[model samples]
Target: MRILARRISVRRTLLKTGSEQVLGIPKSGRSRAITISPQTASLLRKHQLRQKELRLSLGDAYRDRGFVFAKESGDPIQINNFGQRSFANLIESAGVKKIRFHDLRHTCATLLLAKGVNPKIVQERLGHSDISMTLNRYSHVTPTMQDQAARLLGDALQF
Candidate 1:
């Protein structure tokens, strides 16, 4: 499954079930594809190689259910576990504002919108059910967008 330039399809989500995590459909019951740069694709290829090496070295000891990111044993890291065990320590070490794991999604959307990617494209990338949801949820991040739009309008209207 060496998918190219990384048109990564997000199909399954890890859900906490009892003491274990199980793979299931996303909350919206939809699968979405996200395109990545060639550089990102190259890095992911390298990551896959490293993971393969680890899996081979561990032999049967590796859990190996095939997660893009995983623990040494190959078991998927539950979201809560990742936030509590890694994200918090990582933030403290990096000296950044403490942010919830879910906040990363917001940040990504905000950055893309700020960069002036079309709202429709952002909506698909975010798997938003509709354009209004994306626009409404991200309205705060678009004041700068409004300024740019006005400037462009002014430029176009110049005699």
Candidate 2:
């Protein structure tokens, strides 16, 4: 889903849910909007619904932790936490084969290239600071897109 606003607030009675801040800065920053597929959007909506349920279950004892996945004990989510470990374990159990967390990023680029998305658009969605950076990173996966450039030129010339 695209981050429509810089910050979004989620309000709940008797507790302060606070705002979810987008990661970006003004005047040519790296962070930008990324379009999520419809399936992913649905999953995210479901996840949000589950989080609401969790909050309700905890009642007044629920702490207003400003994290998407924070422990009831009020610990901030960290990279080395059980949440990340559990996710890694699930990926391993799925037999995805030797892939690092970083590789998921490359996989997204490859998929976008395979689906014939414009390189520039993909670059924007990925939030590469520059177009050249995106080109350098995914050049190997985007060779076929070169053919489209010739087609575009031909189409333009015919008009």
Candidate 3:
């Protein structure tokens, strides 16, 4: 069940009871598919294969839940515990500062915006209600980007 694609749907969040339920984004109440890098897609494929192997090893004890990330017995990992237990260790091993799991979302948005990605695309990927929200949140203007914008503006006005 490996999917090779740039987009993954956000239809549901798995619960500890092995349930599939849709969860809307707070404030906006919108859910949308997120575009991912090919490298990320490949990583997800490998993770899925590993999960399948774990499930088969568990036999009758395994739950056939549809979570992209699940426990060995197919139970959903608790979000907070996942950060404190799993992510914290990974960050420490990588020698990165300790940051909350939720900060990843902000980092993703900031990186995308910094790379000159369109605000609308970022908004859709982040499930933001509007482009204005995306702009307000991730409008981190670097000196290089500002200089580039100025050059483009000068070129346009020269004509």
Candidate 4:
């Protein structure tokens, strides 16, 4: 299935349901492709190349899994393992507050919404069932955005 996110089109959905956990899919069961920024795309390409090199170096020992992100042995990494190990370590080293990896998704949605990206677009990118879900979940607006909204409303009401 082709996944299209606004103007950007990605080849396939990198993630799928697993035995331990199920990734949420839209109500329609259709995969939605997300278009990422050019910089992000470049980073992904570099990561894919590194993964390929690791796979070749490991030769037969590599698991040869399809998951985009995998352990050095090419084995799929469990969310709990990543969260408690890599993610937690990174947060601790960076001196950031402890937060679940899932919070990153919320942060992304909040930042995008506060930046004025259309709610519908954010919803599509997030693979939410509908725009209302996106609106309800990430309705937080920054103080700067709130001021901008007020100014825009005042201008509109000006005679």
Candidate 5:
């Protein structure tokens, strides 16, 4: 789970079935590679170093399982427990409405689209099967983006 430049290997299987954490491929049934910002790479590197320190301090007491987000013993954290505790606390502390953890993916897509990143690029990052899916899912964000683009174009022409 090294978050190196251009990529971070989370190393967890990407599927959920009922309550069981069955390890397998993603919903698209294929692997995906996405790039990250240098800032993000730096943050992850820091996190990895901290994790290593914890591992070393714990010695044989550390489980050393490869899951990136894990319990004190290095076992995978249960999603339900994470939601009930960490996610809930985070929402309250941030003064934001409670949202499913999965909603972060939708939020990321919408924010990128609104910022004028190409839909195809967003599709690839989201591991969507096709561009249409990304476009359709985030269509609500497009009108505002279109308006922004028009404003920028008009401003340029006025110069």
Candidate 6:
């Protein structure tokens, strides 16, 4: 996890579409550079430290591993193999409804927009090349945000 300016370069999915059928990611596009809040950065840092400790415990056998969690055969880490099912089961056990992993990204965008973050900033953070993409995805802004915008304009006009 590296921070470059307001962007955070992370090893994320880079899928290609259409008939060409490219399975793997390119060197430049595979690594995503996105933005994150300070709190998220702190949490990720802590998680990385914990992962490092776990790797150390595994000794030289774990040296130069490509994933934070993976099989001994060196396949890419997957949530199904990394306790996601267990996590969902726990949530269900706790009376929560089923939720897909992709929902987290939607939730984050909704929260950011609700908090009055500029759409452009949100688009950049989500790695959308255009602001319209972000706007189209999160078209419904919270009522509280609208009220806040009105109040801000009123205050600005007071001068």
Judging by lDDT against the true structure, name the best candidate: 1
Ranking by TM-score: 1, 5, 4, 3, 6, 2
The alpha-carbon deviation from the true structure for residue 112 of candidate 4, after best TM-score superposition, in angstroms, is 1.5
Which order, best to worst by lDDT?
1, 5, 3, 4, 6, 2
- CA lDDT of each candidate? 0.82, 0.59, 0.75, 0.74, 0.78, 0.64
Please list the residue runs of candidate 1 whose C-alpha ends up more than 4 Å from where it truly belongs after superposition: 142-159
Q: For model 3, give the 10-residue run with minimal summed lDDT.
A: 15-24
Q: Under the 3 Å rule for N, CA and C atoms, how many clashes does model 1 have? A: 0
Candidate 2 residue-wise lDDT at 134: 71
Candidate RMSDs in order: 2.4, 7.9, 4.1, 3.9, 3.1, 5.2
Per-residue alpha-carbon lDDT of model 5 for 44-110, expressed as tens digits?
7777788888899999999986766677777777887788889989998999989977778888888
lDDT of 5 at 74: 78
Deviation (Å) of 146 in candidate 5: 5.7
User: What C-alpha lDDT, on a 0 to 100 scale, does residue 130 get in candidate 3?
Assistant: 75
TM-score (all chains, Cα) for each model: 0.84, 0.62, 0.77, 0.79, 0.80, 0.63
Deviation from native of the Cα of residue 10 in model 4, angstroms: 8.1
* Candidate 3 residue spans exceeding 4 A from truth: 1-4, 14-30, 138-159
Tens-digit lDDT track of model 3 for 1-159:
225377787765433434444433344554457767889898888888898898889899999767788777787677868889999998989999889887787777878887878778888877777788777765566788789889989999995
Show the colliding residue pairs in model 2: none
Question: Per-residue lDDT tens digits of candidate 2, residues 1-159?
Answer: 222233223222122134332323433432345556667666666766776687788887767555555566434444344436866897889988766666676777777766777888877766676888776775454556567767888999994
Q: Judged by TM-score relative to the true structure, which candidate is superior, 1 or 4?
A: 1
Which candidate number maximizes TM-score? Answer: 1
- Candidate 5 clashes between residue pairs 3 or more apart in a chain or in different chains: none
Q: What range of 10 consecutive residues in model 2 has the weakest lDDT sum?
A: 7-16
**Ten contiguous residues with the weakest lDDT in model 1:** 1-10
